[model samples]
Target: MTRAFLRPDDARDLVAEQFGADRRLTALDRLAGGSKKGVYRLRLDDETTAILYVWATGENYWPPSPTVPDDPFTDASGAELFATNHAALAAAGVRIPRLLMLDRDNRHLDADVALVEDVGAVTLERLMEHDPAAAATPLSMLGDALRRMHTTLSPKYGKLAAITRGEAPQTRRTEDVIVDRALGHLDAAATRDARLANAHDRIAGHVRLLRSTVTARETYGLVHGELGPDHILVTPAGEPVVIDFEGLAYFDVEWEHAWLRMRFGDAYPVLRPVDLDPHRLELYRYAQVLSLIEGPLRIADTDFPGRQWMLDLAEWNITKALAVV
Candidate 1:
């Protein structure tokens, strides 16, 4: 059975411990777009607010074990992922919401929780829709910040937590991992859609063919695996701060740009890296679409709050996937 979200009273002591006894939680509202973890906005009596992240089984919408346990892209959630990636991003000079408190011991909440500065409700996606001209500066800033992150190299390619703890799996070619994930997504997508099932062989062949064209590369850079405009928070001062860093890893910059291109659409040109391998971009783009198709369909199977939206996303991407092959 699904559990209920935390209530204001439930987190009052937690807020008091970190913030102060004088600051009381007046309201606790669960924000939208948090599928992996619970994101709540806590309003205090002092007219201030903070964001809370709860990493618990109840909060996650995706399957408990969606993919191979060791896969770098497998279920990038949890306090450790957030904390490790947060530290890595800060050290790399990337701007993220300031962390106020982290509860790994589950002292107050039954789950691992983190409290961070609330950067307001406006996301870069919403800002672009409402005021394109006003969004230009923050978008540019986001581009520059992303470029910096994409160029920050790591000795090995893996999740930041694993890399930092020196427990990263044996190094493999970036292309190999990409192809494997894409193929895996394709296999899963095939079972649900008749069109994908019919074209499964053709699509799989195309993916492998694309993989063969890529050359070997030694350098890998830090990348946010799930960077979308919705994940970027625009401050009142018009500065852009990126959120959702749990999927942080060292990977091919082309892979990152491919996702950027898909999510940003025409605006992607503003954030595009000048030196991306076209071959890698093509392969990754197709793979990313396949993932978009598979992941949403997987999530839609559950009683997620966004079930219809997830199904719609899968439907749209299935069309995109068919056009590719």
Candidate 2:
């Protein structure tokens, strides 16, 4: 009876323009697990489907933070960023959903919307849940896709949208960014939870201690800033198509692997992350843990329906942070 985001009819004109005037939108179901944007599956009269991404203010549940949007690690949203990363990845031979339409001019909807080919409901996460053995092939395929993405090098380390548009390159070293961002998260989390506050200095020292062991690099690789089984979709034929390219950027591959290790857990080794820098991985792993803490807590502060899940995530990561000290 009530609607927080765009209704099915709200997107009627937009869908019609994309699929032609004859194709009618039968339904638009908002999928779960999106905190920064509204992800909807649009079913058509012809029994076809497409995914619509709407960057509306009502859709984002992340509470405002000190970090600016330009930061490589900040909230990755907006249609321009999506278009830029999509083009970069698609050009790099990554198998992602085909972009059907992009309405940046707001010709159809008041918000910036993009319509992409529907890869289906079988996420790599879902497939693995049904049968871990069957996920082996998809995991291996994901490893290959990640390799291709990581091999796509960039001279500058930052969001593809910023660097490619002639903006000044991110001059600071990757390690510097990691340390600063982690400290920022530490400070934020401390304000909310007394446990993090008590262990702040100790955990901060641990982060810096790990950072001290890292060396600088001359180049960076393209990475799906957040790569997890959930971010990947498996086609019926067993092909892996990665989604959520908004955070796609050229950065330390270890940063990507740290996230991969966390999300993939025991299934991580299947990706075969070889020749990685241990020092970078360790430091990034700690930083990533802090991020998981702050991110969930921030989202939970809003009207997110998964408030309990977010708090639990922050609590779990809090234990993780305190344990290492």
Candidate 3:
């Protein structure tokens, strides 16, 4: 279930200006899903639709309520990213809100908001939860979605080649940044960038392991960055829809497939007998887990612990890589 910050009435008031007095929000209910964007069931007349409220902030919610910025509450600023992504994905055969109205520039809003069609479908996660044996169905569907998205390149998406087959920006390691900031509190022996001093070397070795396994013939064009049960939604009829494009970047398109492989484990055959380099994939996912731990580390006001956790995951990825590579 997704946590919503806006009360139905408040959301209605904020959006009432868009739909017009005639199209009153006959009903508004919070739909369960999305940790990033605010989703709801909106009704007016005979139409039962979904509306996504985009907040400008990267917090992935429309600013329905106020929480401290550092506290991970709604940020009205990040809406631009969604607007860009939504439009891009929509052009690529993905279904998003109908976009009746949007603060596309959203430069002034505390949270960016957009009215879109709420596709009625159960998330892939729910389907798997209900019927674990059907996991492969969703993965293949996701692959199909990615195929549509990755088939062509667009500047609106920027260069994904930096990270993979396409041009995506290379982001700094969140853990590394955290470590540097928290070093003063850790051992006087530690410097800023509180990451283990040897981590870079280990990652380099792991990168080698990843590169070594690539069979030269394998080429990927883009990366979903984050793809899994939580981000994938399956409609009641077993339609898998990909959501959340904020994490998207150009990289090995196979990584999205890898993402499903990692999360679904043996239940999926998409990457069975996976051939990715063990060290590379391990390092990649280790870096990933570190990214996931950001919320916790920031909350706890700690860095070293999360870095160590990343290393543990890196180790596991190394082992998992051995099986696939």
User: Mind giving the per-residue lDDT tens digits that candidate 2 earns over 119-212?
Assistant: 8989999878888977999899888878888888877888887787877366678888889889999999999999999998999999999989
Q: Provide the TM-score for each candidate, comma-separated.
A: 0.97, 0.96, 0.60
Candidate 1 has an lDDT of 0.87
Q: Write the number of the candidate with greater lDDT, choosing between 1 and 3.
A: 1
Strongest candidate by TM-score? 1
Model 1 per-residue lDDT tens digits across residues 245-312 = 89998888888888888888888888757588899989999889899999998888887889999889
| lDDT of prediction 3 | 0.49
Superposed by TM-score, candidate 1 places the C-alpha of residue 263 at a distance from the truth, in angstroms, of: 0.9
> Which stretches in model 1 have alpha-carbon errors above 4 Å?
65-70, 272-274
**204-249 in candidate 3: lDDT tens per residue?**
3444454445443223344456667777666655656666665555
**Worst 10-residue stretch by lDDT in candidate 2?**
67-76
RMSD of 1: 1.3
So what's the TM-score on candidate 2? 0.96
